[model samples]
Target: MDMDGGWCSLEEIGPLSKLRRLTLHGLEDVSASSLAETARISSKEHLEYLELHWSSSGCMELRDEIEKQQQQEVVEEVLEKLCPPPRIHELHIKGYFGRTLPNWMMVVEACACKSLSILCLAYLPCCTKLADGLCRLPSLERLVIADAPAIKSIGSEFQASSSSSTVDGGVTESTSAAFPNLKYLSLVGLCEWEDWEWEEQTVDVTAGAMAMHALERLEIMKGKLSCLPPGLANNKRHALRELNLVELSNLTSVENFPSIVELIVCDCPKLKRISGLSRLHKIGIGRCPSVEVLQGVPSLHSIELEDGTIERLPGYLPCVNPKFLKLTCSKELHGSIISGSSSEWEKISHITKVVIYDIEDSDEG
Candidate 1:
């Protein structure tokens, strides 16, 4: 039942205790947070999936600071009242313009969905920080944050803070790691992000507080991320298997993910170095010409390189251990590789399979 865009209208849904899934659209049109509590969302224990969406009008840019703050307060209050059950599996929030998320999603001890497994936050243009308690979720496996442009930094708030307790003895207590069950993660179109400050503290990592310990695949693309956060690099679990870096405008290097089996790098113009992965096997690279150092992977088997501007093979080719090479290049570069005078063939003689494509040949085929 829908009634004229008011939270009081949701009261009819309150007693529908068996509701398994709910999608509330036009959340921005609602007022009267006090009425939201009467909907009794907390009582819907069978509810597993929830979507809260606001209108797209306010997400592009704020009209003014005062109006933004007022809207944030009202939305937060409404969300606080509409908290999901503790064991809800999936929560998706889209088109949220609020600067901060509601307390039900932030505060660790009181987080709304402790059993959340798949969480997606998209088009959150005004949020500066991610939910602080995201790290505390033990069951979350897939998490994605997309198209948030205002965020400048990802601070230690993304990590689970350690709590200290002293018993009769001087022994200290320990907290669990962040993103313990996270396997697949993606961060896309965060255009304004600049810093990732995960400062190692007295209780961080040494007491087995490594975050994303179970993460297997990570994708970071289309951001100002110059470097990976320490939280990722310092993970002792070495469980990450696939690393994808694409279109990152300022990223300069890719290294130190020891367990990675396949690495993909494309359109990252400023990236210069890739090294120090002992288990790497396959690599795909496209339009990333500044990469001058590619070394330290003895187990590599295949290399797919695409560059249309080069007149000669890249200097790093002689250092790679891949037995199969597939290359795309300019016609002049292809001519140089075929010419007996060029060292290109001599450089790749050890490869068991080699395929080449020039721009003209590619266009015809």
Candidate 2:
């Protein structure tokens, strides 16, 4: 209930009708759309959770394009009259500068929020796609699209389409498997997201083309992604474990994720390869500087490297066989790994436990 500035008495929520949860901020000063359908909010059938905000000065401080398409057609008619009923299960739209989004979020198989299991669309400085049959949500499980800088491209209809079922009596053709129980997906600050078309294929079972099959966790931050999407970095449909990449300026390579265990990379300035993850255990690379590969991990345990502009001690650490190694270098790679006869101290002497901090005695310099 954060109906900021203008427009009130919008039918006073039409007697709330047992509104379970709702938050409406500014809503770009909704002027009409029948005053937002008199707040009937899809007949509030036990509305589960919903938040629609608009007002980062409404439409990211518009730069006039016919007044930002008349404020995106008045916030797309107040989000098509704030439709959410049908047991909404958590929906969040923030600072929406709509450019086509509400038509009740597609999902048709007779959808009206098939108990939506969490959907977030943030900042949205003029949405451009995303929200097309959401792979026919079958109890969606956490999807977050942040900042949304006018999304650039994400094709293959974002997974699963071509449908038809009438078995044993005619037509037959199946490919259903898109976010089929999504576990977690976060795409942040999509600053001109560079194409994603899902290519990695190896017949993702059940009649091909699966997507996000019970995905474990995936995070893409500040995108400009130059790859990934062969149905998800292909390693032949393995329920991903965890893969977090940040500041992907032009992702170079994060090879086939064959059931990744954990990998967190930051400031990916043309990340140069982190080869095939074969059930990798742990990794945290920061300020990546053309990483030179950590080939087919053999179940590594842990490694957290933070390069404060390296000067050594990162030849991919003797092809990691982690047992725990923190190291935040660049005090000349912490004096070349404490000079234990440098070779980066025998490439972390079969690492069993090593922690070194350098960059001017770390305090996050």
Candidate 3:
């Protein structure tokens, strides 16, 4: 229902016992206290999903005003009330801007959301407590945290205590454990980070150990990741199939991905080498001026290079066994393609097919 600038109480919506989905948008007058109450009192036995979007400018002001202990008490009361004996399966919150993650989040994590499989939070401000609380959800299968500007580290206070388990000889325990069932994770637009190093420690040993073993896909875009988390480099599962790294300007190398089938690197101008991908099937490279090699990838089937200028192909190019190759370049660099001998040409010809589309002709036509 359209409830913009209207006064409504949680009791008004609580009797939706069979409601499977609920959406609240453009709520200008609903206080955080009331919203929290609505979530707490609403019958969640059949509620599988809840979406709340507060886009009014005044909501921003409300966030600033609600930080008092008394206001927080109202939120706590609502959360305590909404703690379902059995949690819903999915929860999505957008445009949430409180300084700290609400306490009900912890309630959802600890008990109310035992069956939760997916949780996504977008456009949140930086808060470690929120991150910590999210890690407490035990049944999470897919976790996505996007456009959170203030978060610099992944481990928050809610990290589970370390456990003793070994996978492929890699240390597989952390003090904090969240997302135990997660199979896919995507983190995008985390801009406040200049680097991912939170300690003088050699690598994030703890964070790496907590990754869900079933994880198969990872995508990190436009974050301040100067280097990838060490856990990704050391994880043993060959289940990882796809990786996309976009606009991470500080990334200089890719030293992981043993079973990865597809790799896409775009807008990373400073990248110099791709040395770690040993089983890549498809490679797409774009806007990288300094890349010098596409080596160590044995199963590569397709390659696309766009707006990139490299002096020479990697020494391993002569050994590549790909089925499809597409390279687009400007007129000034067209001569480079003609001059480079087909040291790898025999291998290219042996492949199933090859199609080279020249962009210059398209521009001229």
Give the poorly placed runs of model 3, Cα more than 4 Å off: 1-9, 32-35, 38-43, 59-85, 106-110, 126-130, 156-178, 195-210, 308-319, 334-353, 359-365
Give candidate 1 regions above 4 Å deviation. Answer: 1-9, 59-65, 110-112, 161-164, 167-173, 199-208, 338-341, 359-365
Error of 3 at 310 (Å): 6.1
Alpha-carbon lDDT of model 3: 0.62
Worst 10 residues of 1 by lDDT: 200-209
Task: Tell me the tens digit of each residue's lDDT in model 3 across 1-365.
Answer: 24345645555666657777666664333555556556443455787776665442443345465444444344334334444435478777666554566655653435647787887877765343345555556677888878788776554233343234666769664444445667788888876655542221234444334445456788888866767655556546466788899988787887666878888899887788886677888988877777776778777888876662444344444566787777666644444454445443443455566554345674577
In model 2, which residue pairs have backbone atoms overlapping below 3 Å? 198-229, 199-229, 199-230, 200-230
TM-score of candidate 2 to 2 decimals? 0.38
TM for every model, in the order presented, reads 0.89, 0.38, 0.76
Per-residue C-alpha lDDT of model 1 across residues 132-224, encoded as one tens digit per residue: 778777789999999888888888768654244676678765456677789999998888888988754433356245667788899987888
Cand. 3 TM to true fold? 0.76
Winner on lDDT between 1 and 3 is 1
Per-candidate RMSD, Å: 3.3, 15.3, 5.8
